[model samples]
Target: MTQRRRGDLLVIGGSEKKDSDEERAILRQAARKALEEDGGRIVVLTVASMEPEPLAEIYQKAFGRLGVRQMEVLDIRNREQAYEPANVEKLAGASVLFFTGGDQLRITSQMGGSPLLERIFALHEEGAAIVGTSAGAAAMSETMLIGGPTNRSCLSTLAMAPGLGLLKGVIVDSHFTERGRFARLMGAVAQNPHNLGIGIDEDTAVLVSENDEELTVLGSGAVYVIDGRGIRFTSLSERHPERILTVHDARVHVLGRGDRYNLKERRPIVPSLERV
Candidate 1:
């Protein structure tokens, strides 16, 4: 399945370091619409695990004042240059790749199944344009949240792990609603109730298309999306390790900043402002 689109991704939750003008005009209009649909390339800034002096010279000088005048900083956190497959084929010739925040277990313990994460999933299935923020959107979810104890009255270290699924059936949980994280994704979907729980917030972003789980949101915060299929969940069921849960019709969408949502018709759309 060669499913990927060459543009549109600006998952930010850390952009607003006062370079205002509405965050440099939404990072120069999503880097000029991903370089007008992938022709004017180069915007790779994985920063591996980050902190190479103010996050690679301050986000490569603020994405080179927003035109993204070429950038490449594959630090991959030195667990041996993140298991080189020629540095993931030079970050799969990035048309736009950014993952920087920190410690989603150091990116699934140094890029899981590394060949630079299978050439960043073969450069996002040969189309390019993948973005992440806040531990790179909590490790692009197939279950991930390696930091524990939110102390919102839940812990077993609130443990739920595994990630770098690059957005499959979802579970992303960034600095959601400014770190309350709604009981750590409501106890991580009550111990994984058929997955599909995101919590972005903190400048916000949700933007899905390939495989089109029909998400769409942007900056200035909010995106909860819980959707635990029906109300009859049993929290890891009998032989339970202390998780008795029940949620009837559990759905919560609280979007903002150009809202649109339809993760398989869970519905909400109607945005076309046209303000450039």
Candidate 2:
């Protein structure tokens, strides 16, 4: 088993509202935490998006509105740019590193095994807060859901790929409910029963702890955690690619805003209400 590292993660499910409404304050909360941790300094990585500058500017304005004055956008286009010492050095002394939404595969393929990625990992291990929205969120885990069948099926082929590995022992799927991706996530869990499948709905997030033991849900939508540890059997590998999959004994837990979960324990923790 791989040892989990220490770091805070703000994994947004994607399509998070970035306005001033308190009802839609998920991104604001993340920005506030990042500002508090690193004295308002933030590094935004746009490696996932094809149009890096535009995406970076969007976040720049978003975080800027949240009072993050010192924000630098690292527009690393390719693997060659990832190897640049100056580009890699952009992560140094940053209190927070934020990844924008786009193609998760682009992130892993371009930055994987690069010195820049190592620096990002080092900073994360050193207590810097890492934030990802949408594809960025999906790429945080060790096992990532790339592409899969939209319809429910026992024989559906769900593609899996290596991610940033910021969080381990789990797989994350974004735009879960809105996109009707429950079957896809279920297929992923059926294929790899040892790992947990987390399906996060749009406008929500799972705030993961540094120890990787706990996570708290934020935003209006829900977070679904599928645990396959109790799974008795699965015919995902044996069945033909066109056949429906068969899975048994997979436990699932649904969490809403303000709900907390114990990741290591594979259970939900009831929140305590204290009166002031």
Candidate 3:
């Protein structure tokens, strides 16, 4: 029997409102997860950002407003910094680990094989909520979509690399509709049909459950799930990367707030509405 995967994940699609006046429903959930344990703590990791302080400050105030008193910001610049004893110790008591958006490559390259990542995995197994926004969200998958054409789908235009692999068998692309990344995400799914492609829009998020079986949509925008498991054909093997991608029988499901999807079944479960 397969052991159940531990930890919940809040995968945000860039540009979630951080102000006190605005509706920060997504961040609110993160706060709730962080405060689950008695000595509840939150750790904001800014390792992905070039200028980590600003992002760190933003989350510090945001989480603070949400009543997270025990919070710390971890700014790990290089691999050397990621291996530091103090940096690893910072994650000791964290109930929630939030990763800020920037370059997905930075997050993997810096802490890929370090003690920091090992500790994070251990914490995840202990049921810590791992939250990430934009690039940070993209890095949660095993295969990360590094760069590719947003407007068109082409084999040559698509670039993929190894990611943190926090979430397996799924590839995440943030700022989905706002950035018009539909084609690119489809391109990724075309290349790897077994993996599910999730395109998240701005201000939106897909909260992955601790068991990793269900994903619930949260926030204002929609979450697009591209299921290429039923795909019959693809132009991926062709020599021309410039040519338009030809994929057959790719099913797409657009999930709004409160919608749930079963990852194992590869199906969406839309909530029924009541007559007013």
Candidate 4:
């Protein structure tokens, strides 16, 4: 059987520095990958935001400053727009599909089961890079964290829904430390112990390699990996909605820039100081 080829995915936490002249490493990496094919054509999807144009414009200038000459913005506002032929055509031949920060639910609701999303899946399988930030990043996982209390995790406190499922085996939470969402993420993993929970800090990102088995940390902040496979117990069914979540033996790994992780092995890979 022939296997499908998939592109790299950059799942970024919210609030990446856009106006800085120092170095836009994340955006630069995105632009460079897009330019490697299809004449550097990039399609920015602002479907997650209520005000899509403003967000789209921000990326336009950011990518433009990075020497990306060809770019298009698809501000898909509703389910109807997602099925439009014009919108579907915009994705054709694009080398990158970028999702901006906003409500992750908006992304799944509008684009789910639509032709536009199907086309995007096709593009990804054909080597087009899939990039998402903030809520966009959260929606990339199989399960999404919709809403919950920030500082604490309790049974029935978190609201979760099915995500876009472009990436799987994990649940993602963005702006993790800045917004105090650690507890909520822990609750999620406690409920679903088989799936890993990833909490990403602002300006940070986890780049899933093309093989889909590894992740490389990018940007200045940290990435928290919550492993529940070793979890011995969770008090989800035994506790009330507001009761604090209790999970025993859950392993946590904090990774910094240049750190690499093996998703399949569920372990962190130490970086070598020597240059390759």
Q: Which one is best on lDDT?
A: 3
Clash list (residue pairs), candidate 2: 153-245, 154-244, 154-245, 155-243, 155-244, 155-245
Candidate 1 all-Cα RMSD: 15.6
Ranking by TM-score: 4, 3, 2, 1
lDDT of 1: 0.66
Give the TM-score (vs. native) of candidate 3: 0.95
TM-score of each: 0.33, 0.93, 0.95, 0.95
- 190-229, model 2: which lDDT tens digit per residue? 8778889999999999999848889999998999999999
Poorest lDDT segment (10 consecutive residues) of candidate 1: 148-157
Misplaced by over 4 Å in model 1 are 1-43, 47-66, 75-77, 80-97, 100-108, 111-135, 140-159, 162-187, 191-216, 219-224, 227-238, 241-245, 248-251, 254-276
lDDT by residue (tens digit), candidate 4, 117-207 = 9999998988889999998999998999999887654565579999999778899999999999888888898888888999999988999
| TM-score of predicted structure 1 | 0.33
**Model 4 alpha-carbon drift over 4 Å, by segment:** 1-4, 273-276
Residue pairs clashing, model 3: none
Global local distance difference test of model 4: 0.88
Q: The CA-based lDDT of model 3 is what?
A: 0.89
